[model samples]
Target: MSESKSAKSGGTAGSRAGGTEGAATSARIGVLKTYKLFVGGKFPRSESGRVYEVTDSKGNWLANPPLASRKDARDAVVAARKAVGGWSGATAYNRGQILYRIAEMLEGRREQFIGEVAAGEGLSRAKAAGRVDAAVDRWVWYAGWADKIAQVAGGANPVAGPFFNLSSPEPTGVVAVLAPRRCSFLGLVSVLAPVIVTGNTAVLVPSEERPLPALSLSEVLATSDLPGGVVNVLSGRASELGTPLAAHQDVNAIDLAGAGPELARDLEIAAADNLKRVVRPAPDREPDWRGDPGTARMLPFLETKTVWHPVGS
Candidate 1:
């Protein structure tokens, strides 16, 4: 009987050991993800080699995004300028296809964006999901505009002379965009979609505090058939990057939607050095991004060009 009891006790201890080992295997730690900047169709670390901690709305540590420097901003501008010719020359229908593909990719990664938006904006999961949907929809909306904008904005003009006078809108070349501080994702799509749909390349400065979503967006763009440097994202202080971009001699326009009152004034002054087209923010308050985005946002970055040809030539 004593021998039997000893065997049973040994079996019980072995069973407990197996259970402990299984628990340990199940409780393994997860690997963390390191985010990088998207530049010229590639992911690159900042030239400054500096990173700042990005926290959630509740002050919880999220991740460290690169602290973009003046050099980084200039590099982005170079990338944007390099891409201008090919991107602007592409047919509008092709541009629309690429933009729609971006929407499809964004929809595929909807859950991930929902989480990031929730954490960054301090919204509930449902609300964050809603914002993500809106952002995706915004891309589709802009894609549709790609082929139609020309029809709506351009036409034949009657002239007294025996010549055909045609007026059409053309891209204003490289544009420097400041992504809004609030509505990080939706506002970003709102401003950025308009610029690129018309065949203009952009050097975008995402929201300083909530840049994770924008960084993730770069991943989508890289795979969405967009040419290298068509959209370069630099994550850092807007004021730091916007100042250089506004004054950039090569940049064709400046969108100050994300700048504060004081910074906006300064950027406008700098933009004057090159007579860059400026999209000034509202004087009273931030415009509601959820409202219908009319053609107002797209008009500033477009220049009307008139072509005259002899009728009988």
Candidate 2:
């Protein structure tokens, strides 16, 4: 009789444990279902109705994911152009605060992003975390510049003739940038912050091989109180969108990175049509990622506008 009671009690305990295990698994799956492309404060599928395969570092194909197309790229540009003014018009102090917010958010989510970088960049977890930390630090650095870039980069230039003249910086509206093929998110943020801090809009093309962080960044931007249209991101073949963006009459500047001579020449010609300012590539060599951010990152977004006031007697 005692053996029979013992068997019955054990079966009841096993059933309860199975029920709890099933509930925990369901919750995990629920979290995975929440991801999608971010656009205009909403999560959306690629309007092109196309999806491509995403893979993990282990070479395992992640499920169906939207392939952002040319049309989608253009759409992102439209959004960025729309947001340019208000974000740029904001007092530099407020802009700096918003940038600081992003850094805080990144730090809080460090572990999640670190793992993703490991899977996406094929970096070890420690290395990926190191890069992530650097990226977050980069944001904090730019946050300080949001209000002060003008004073640092601009000054009174003694001219052949001038009457109490001063030259100050201004934002160039609607910038298009191609991020470096390596150091994905760090490169993307480096290109972006200077432009936005100065009030220009941007459309960024992330590194082709690893794009997950760029998408994730879009999500962060969506929540960061940045106006829509200030920063647009597209992930696809850089060649496909490079010419259109660099040459587009509406865009004011093109920051080129990670391309060969053929593309470089093509963009140079396209930029000439409008006399748009083009930030040339660093000489055929690797970037010193560990170097200081000010000269390396901030200088590219600057323009030397000559204040031409006639010298009066």
Candidate 3:
């Protein structure tokens, strides 16, 4: 009887171990996602075929986003230049419609953004959600501005002695923007929307540590009828791409919001090569993107042209 009991016990133990092994084998391991750059409304891996790992705040593996190179920056500039005329020539009302469409799409995908922001920024769910909500509302705000900026900033000038004099604000062509590093979503939209709202095509380099949200946002822009090339997003180290963008003669303007003091100065000097319109950060003072970002941010990329004609008899 004792020998038979021992055999049964050993058999039961063996079955239990086998069951554990099967469970382990069946466990699901998440497939790591690869995020690519958004250029000319298309998703493409870096021309260099290189990718860098992006980790969460706690050092947890998040994704491997494409590491954009100087070549990518130049390509983005070319795309932006191609898109400039059509986008800038569109009616302001049409631009407003498209901007509003972005808001609508973002609304539909709010939860996804909230989760991304939470993970990317190391914020609580509630706080991250708040950031997403603000970002969506920012689009709505800029949508309204799209149709109103001209009225507020351009008009018939009352000249001392002129037949008919009018001042018009026009987009400054292709703009390269280095988005702020800390406030990934909000800061990005705050700078980007203004540039494009005025009808300028943009090449945006997002915050390195927090690029996932911007990459996801690019997906929204791609489907939102904003037109390809109007907004191209490159995700990688800003240091690698900034100088090339600044020095590119085809690029008409740049926003150095992401560069450190020394880098910002260097880029500003390079921008002088082509006389690029640069918006440099203040010394040791980062502009608060969350607060009301009035017309001050939008006016920099706009050029005012004055036209005068003799009064018709």
Candidate 4:
């Protein structure tokens, strides 16, 4: 590639030479747009046929992902519900292996991701790289949990008489997650792993503004042999998808976030219809979020089930 082309395509869509920032999207520069939603192990447009432009932090056109409609949301919920039983039935050790592969894929793509975020989110090279690295590390942390959460949250129970009782953490069937409005990669993985680690199938909607990495994460999930539909993801307005899942009879729980108060209210009210377990709102959430969605997020989505049987004389 020539020096000019190389400069335009190197990393960020803008240059910081001589401490001056300039747009790299001259008509002559080559660019591409992404336009599809990852669903049911395939990429397709909204059934209602809508599309929206996504811009990099530089405002250069990045892609036009499908503007998933309510029908699309219903379809994704069907996918999640379909896979819940098989996913929950998988042995914990096997589940751990597949989740660990996600960590491996993320580690391999660390630099590319750092560069993407650096260019896409306008963070300095160092900060972007750090965020990418942290995101990968977070995946590894949760990978370990796939085989261990039960140890931490489940155990043998003491019975009052000559009877036996055992309490164990189990998948709550299908889950719906409204990813944080900030911190795309880390928060996405944090929210997803815990849901699936317990054997729950999740239908995750990425933050509208920063859906690229979420789609990329879906790519990794696809390759990792997570049973198709075990962890479905969509990139569109959360409001467009949130309401249906919060109230969907098949979805056992919903993790809420993205935007502000109005979105929260809609989710809470929708969830009330089913008494669906819901994750509450956070302060100033973003599309580039990072935190343990397990303790705080997963706990609420999960329920404690105790089995009691009597050994009588």
Which candidate's lDDT is highest?
1
What are the runs in model 3 whose C-alpha is more than 4 Å off?
A: 1-31
lDDT (CA) per prediction: 0.86, 0.69, 0.85, 0.73
- Supply every candidate's count of residue pairs whose N, Cα or C atoms clash at under 3 angstroms: 0, 2, 0, 11
- If both were scored by lDDT, which would come out higher, candidate 1 or candidate 2? 1
The alpha-carbon lDDT assigned to residue 142 of candidate 4 equals 72
* Candidate of highest TM-score: 1
Q: Stretches of candidate 1 above 4 Å error?
A: 1-26
Rank the candidate models, highest TM-score first.
1, 3, 4, 2
Residue clash pairs of candidate 1: none
Worst 10 residues of 4 by lDDT: 12-21
**How does candidate 1 fare on TM-score?**
0.91
List model 2 lDDT by residue over 36-127, tens digit each.
45544455777777656555556644334456676666676677667776876799899999889988888876765665566666777677
lDDT of 1 by residue, 155-239 (tens): 8999999999999999999999998987889989999999999999999999999898899899999999999999999999989
Task: Provide the lDDT at 94 for model 1.
Answer: 98
Backbone-clash count (model 3) = 0
